[model samples]
Target chain A: MSELTVELAGVRFGYGAAPILDGVDLTLGAGEFSVLAGANGSGKSTLLKLLVGLLRPNAGTVRVLGGSPTDPDIRRHVGYAPQGLRMATSLPVSVTEVVAAGLAPSKGMLRRLDRKDWTRVTEAIEAVGLGDLSAECLFELSGGQQQRAILARALVGHPRLLLLDEPTTGIDQRLRPALVRELRHRADDGATVIAVSHDPDEFHEVCERILVLVDGRLQRITHEEFHHQFHEHGAPG
Target chain B: MSRLFIDFAIQAYLAGAAVGIAAPLIGCFLVQRRLSLIGDATGHLAFAGVAIGVAVGVAPIWGALLTALVGAVALEWLRAKGRLAGDVSLALIFYLGLALGLVVLSAHGGLTASSTGVLFGSIFTITWLDVWTIALLCALVVGAVALFYKELVAVALDEETARASGLPVDSLNVLLVVLTALLVAAGMRVVGLLLVAALLVIPVAAGARLAHSFRSAMLWAIAAGLTSTLAGLVVALLQGTIAPGGTIVLAAATVFAVAAVVGRRAARRHPRSSAA
Candidate 1:
């Protein structure tokens, strides 16, 4: 909890020519439960991607876990859940198969999961309340349940840092608190968590820190200030 | 059928069996990724490639492989750029391959009834070289899939998530297309260019209907592919006039129909989850 797990100095990035994150300097401490709130296309998701090493910075240095985010070894310790409902629902993949993929980078794709891996996968699934649906096909689950499946996938590897992009989008209203609690529990156990959300109210309930992405810069905002600003600007008049 | 008949068609039989396993195995990902038409698109390009080989006097399969690889590259380019939708790009290449094939076949003047077998597949003409080539190609596809199963599953399930997780998304995509080209090239022998897509797509479709898990679906797909190929070959041999490739496709279709019904019934019996 005392260690700096993420440090980005003068990081500049964009797609094609339109800049998204420009000269951004940021740092996150270990065991920090933080929410990144931003308008659509405000670089919130991009920041998470940059943290996970999915996008190489245009300029400046991005270090995750004291190594370049691009390093596979560094990324192996970073659990990331991307935004959007991208999982092909019609695809006949069981919940376990989805979670098992988190082990792929370490296990090398074709290797069968040993007992330990299976145990971790089961624990992760149960953590998200998907124990009963482990063998069920993805298309057989509701939208919220599917989101849990994706969460279980990210959690299966139990990385040192967790970066989730809108992890609550399709999640059930009832299960949302449990999901946050699980993440909170992980943070309490000394894992850094950085999550992106358009709606950060529920996230604020469990997270200790809240940062808003505005004008391509990370601005620290109090939990009360964030919800106030969100209502003022985000709500339709 | 006598043992002599079995012995004589052993090469074709072996090639067919390999297609039964390899085509559907690869097709599992292709179908899951919504790139199932890739087999047909590559097949069309293989058609043009084989025609060039036939007209130019090089090995037809080699020519098909070249064309298929070229098509795969084009597909990869289109996919990466996000410029053209997959099917549109495939359609563009499909027409080019089909038109080129027709022009080349007409200009070459070597297309007789037997030459028709080139497009329709003449398993009766399978050689030891053909069997070895198909076998070698199948082995590579299977081995690559086995070695990279997790990466492929990750990418296919969700490319962006897999990329974010540090999987080599671009290289894996290239690997997928290259493998598709190779399978299409090899599949041209047993099912011919016209019906090669059938073995690659239909089995996976049927498998999806029957299997609840990804592994089960792929296993079921292999079963469907193997049985259809075997039955089709046997029926085509017995019938004497039916095309082997077309007959195999029909057999796969029948299997898909049966699987759909059985799978639907099985699913109803469980009613396990409320997935939308």
Candidate 2:
């Protein structure tokens, strides 16, 4: 029973010949909440993906939940919400179905959702403020609303380890505090939450320390330092 | 309608009805995923497989299934590798499958009757066995679709998010392509290889236009597929010369055209929210 929820040492990764991440080392403990912020294409997304076991490092060890990331059990307990617009509006799925899919894999092959599953799905939808729109087609949603729906899907399973890349990109600033509180509650409920954001202030009260990426390297910085660099230096979007 | 009616017409009608429900049931997901061309690609490969099966004295449907599976895997692989876009893979597969089928057909002149059946299906030619084949396959296709319904929709919505959530994106994608292959191979007997994709796509597109939810979209698609088949079969029987394949595809297209108009009118009546 390792205390760390995520561990990566001497991690190296590249898409083709160009190195996207190299010589990186990181560790996160159980129930820890942390924020990773960096400029665009600064490997913030990559780190979140690694934690969720979505990508494998080329040259180093990546352990999630104290075991191989490729393990099915490890994958089942982890939830990930990727960055960017990941919806195909052409799909006819409703908000409920989209979030219900978070439970599909765990239900295993050839099984449909039961009463308990739907209950959880409803609760998750409500948490993201899309309870009224759960029956509406996802394509009918605004971008910010859609992003929150994705967040709800990620949190539906109450995963032991959760990773969100740029969770606030399309979200409204007014909704920021409630979203932070929601994530904080999940962390308080004994889950490790690692979020990637450009604005650390959104997560200042939730995270212990801010992790910054510079030239594919990881650096630990204080919240004050993060805000200063973020606002004054105008860290590239 | 009196003289055009044949003794074996019931089998053809039954087979068509089965495919009408099954093809569009799968097609709804395909159209949503924008992989509507997969049916055409698989149909072509199934043709090559059928030709080889005819030459070897085996069930042509089995041959078609094997070839379609291989082609589906190839399409999935090529699409995943980033070497080619999905439609590009579809085009490449259909061309190769047709080329392979032609070569095999040219080598066996005695197999003309069988090949003709696959290319331009005859409702009068359908036997009770053919109906059974269509029924069993249709049941399997529909069953698989229902069993993995959520997973399939999840992948179609967004592969990355689905994968991040621990759904087997690759496996589900493979299953979907193979199921598409199965539908096309089963449908080839009724709709013919050339028009199988049309049967898969048109009904689903029509359904998507009218539907407000996923379940409704699937139901509409199934209705469209069944209606097109029933209407097309009757028209073909009355016309006496036109194949059911052509008539069925045309009927589906007409349904789609009508749905397009209705959907547009409805959209105008209720404007979408200002967020695409």
Candidate 3:
């Protein structure tokens, strides 16, 4: 078997007494691209947050790259693109600046980004087809363009583990395939990729596995099984 | 205009210029973080500190600096502990500081000319020592911004992203507030405790509307700040009746108006290029 890049056992968590995720077990090996599906408030994003160490599980352990997700050393190899950008939209940060910031975590405090890091930033921008708008303020871009810029930020670091929440949000339909192709490329390059997406079928061909959150537990299903289940349920609302 | 170059006027100009340069430099982040009013809150707390300093016979600015620093830390602590929302914490500090300042000064023998000077700043009142102090603190603020520009911008842009990426989000937050406290205290002599936040926020607002990028926004903000301060001083000098703090804030507000108009026209001309 491929080396496990993520390991979670009997994880339980919630905002309050009522648990959102209970007795959840999941593990993903390197080079595996998995898509997580769930209804609204089914803890899909929360689970991704757990994997990124943004939230801690109330019970059980979450280990990524043989260490706790909260560990900075481990976090250095992780890239996360949340569903929606959580920044003040009014702030005049350019696409290039935002993508460059993706390198900030790995750079640590006080160390400046050298030329190599900037080259990586530029490459990521080019990869997302945003090279022309690199200097434009993020807020000035159309919704789809902004999403691509965020994707560029996530891709800039070239992390060994990439977690995305609704990564295709606001992306143009024509560009969706390319985005999925990029994810597959990252996974093929030995990165562990997990995406929490409402529409899992978009990733059907590239994803090796699909997991659905039902009543707070992960139900690992094959792509065909998910397709059948999805058809039967008329897809998650 | 000829009197503007005199030793006393030059000292005031230096002090005002320093505040101008430093306040907006730090204000760019604060504005981006939606903590623009933090300057006002800390300024009020610094006012209380100045009162305490006078009550105990210390230099008022030093007292303001110490109190503002402590207040800044306390505000962060309260927010982190989830005891109060950020705005509530700021409001609490704001009212408490002002009231405490009022009570302290009233009990200590009423509001004197010097204490009122702290309220409504006068450019001519600045000492060479005040100039040096403001310059030093301004220099420190500039150095900090220079050293941590990327980290600061990253944190301000998207705090969660910055944290998830491995930047020291919490420490950087503290540094921001600490630097804000320093700027508020340092600016009190030129713009006074009440109006210092104007220097901190208005210029950044104008700059953000006009500039296309964060770097450009910062540059524009500093330029606007300097313009407001220097112009306000000259106006106050010419008028001789108005306070420099009041004039400085008005000048900044004027700059904001022009930037808003220009930004609106530009956005109209290029709808796609305009910021949301």
Candidate 4:
């Protein structure tokens, strides 16, 4: 599609001899909010890593935003929040600093953040409801708060494509809706959002499509079918 | 018109001042990356370099710099390749340097008077030429850190995120180790090879205990470094018998002890600002 944000064609990948993803082909357009669901260790995170260029496929191509994901020019317009990723507590980096790091892709190296860039950092912090804790160390925050800060980092760039892995892992249930709504807003603003979640219902209101990984292949199913399959098979893998 | 000898202690102080400022500037990131021991490892490698230089009749500082640079680059390469665990590589480098230096020196002759100076540090033996050389290296280190502050912070904070964000993660990692090598070479004469890592790590610990952000931690670490170094040099000057290297490390340790206590109390008082 002319407005497609992601395209994967015959992609195959694995850690060693065993394969995780085999002959996978998919496409998603701009402004689409999608959920990737599978059992634990079913290659959902690996697939997201491929989209972000953190991991390369063993075969085939993964194109994001009209170019190879590994290209710096292309990556500048992509944002990713890895699963359960946390900075070392020994480091004294603050919330604002971590969120500001999100701008590095856009700014490149050797260029300092201007006043406007910092203001955007602050705006991202406030948007994630961490306005009061902007100056606090990231490790000092609760797990949920840290996840929110990470979300803010992913959101700060206003990227054309956003990939989040277990974005709601530590987020409070009461706050999950707000988090999903934020992702919804970003997708509505034309950013392609693909999130890996064990429970896709958490994103039921915002997600337009659900993709399940089973036998190293992607299967697209409707919400009703997904619910039936979930109850029938215990969980999709 | 010139005296037969100038105050070498004064020369040592001048050079120490540069080290005090630069070592901790590099230390902030090293400590953040949990590679504090890299300083110690590089220092030992520099010692081996210095020994080889002495054997070949080159300036020991240059030898130390060359060897340390090569060693830093090698360690980074190994770690980046993921063939060796980071700590294992560091340990191998550390012991290899120490043994290589000792064997080389023993083969030439037992530890000479100069070798002892390189080990324990001899402030009264510093030449004015050394002052200028150390100052130049420290300036270069400081300038590089300032220029790459944002990229360095992003990489040190979380490397995966930084790489995903399009930063040259591998290049930045190499830059950090190169800076560490340069610092070890610069400070070896003042802090001695055995204790140089103290300068790279202790002040950072003290600063991290009291500062809230990476920027402030660096400022505080630099402040602590200067205080320990200048004060230790003064104490050595007054005492006349103490080694400046040992005194400087002690001063830094004292600062860390006090900061730990004060930081604990402050954390109790303002639970949210403990990171500061």
The C-alpha lDDT values of all candidates are 0.84, 0.82, 0.87, 0.87
- For A128-154, candidate 3 gives per-residue lDDT tens digits of 878888998888788778888888888
Report the lDDT tens digits of candidate 2 across residue range B172-207.
889998888888878878988878888788898898
DockQ of 3: 0.61
Highest TM-score against the true fold, candidate: 3
Candidate 2 regions with alpha-carbon error over 4 angstroms: A16-18, A228-237, B1-6, B83-89, B111-114, B274-276
Pairs of residues at least 3 apart in sequence or in different chains that clash in candidate 4 = A214-A237, B210-B276, B211-B276, B212-B276
Native contact share for candidate 1: 0.72
What stretches of model 1 exceed 4 Å from their correct place? A10-23, A39-41, A53-61, A109-111, A198-205, A224-237, B1-5, B83-86, B103-109
The regions of model 3 sitting more than 4 angstroms off are B86-89, B273-276
Better of 1 and 2 by lDDT: 1
Every prediction: chain A TM-score: 0.92, 0.93, 0.96, 0.96
Winner of 1 and 4 under TM-score: 4
Per residue, candidate 1 scores C-alpha lDDT tens digits across A191-211 of 899988867778867887678
Residues A1-237 of candidate 4: C-alpha lDDT, one tens digit per residue: 549899999999999898999999999999999999988788999999899899999999999988999888888888999877556666487889999989986886779999999989998888777888999888777888888889899899899999999899887787788889989999999999999998888988999989999888998877778999886868764
Worst 10 residues of 1 chain B by lDDT: B1-10
lDDT of 2 by residue, A1-237 (tens): 338888889988877787778778888887888888878888888877776677888889999888887677788788888775576556467889878878876777778889999999999999987887888777777888888888888898899888988777787788878888899999888888888887787898888888888877788888888767767877645
Model 3 Cα lDDT, one tens digit per residue, B1-276: 687777877888899899998999999998898888778888889989999998998898899999999988887777667775657767877899999999998889747888877876755877888889989988989999899988898888888877787777888889998999889778888888988888989999999889888999999999999999999888888787788889889999999999999999998897655322
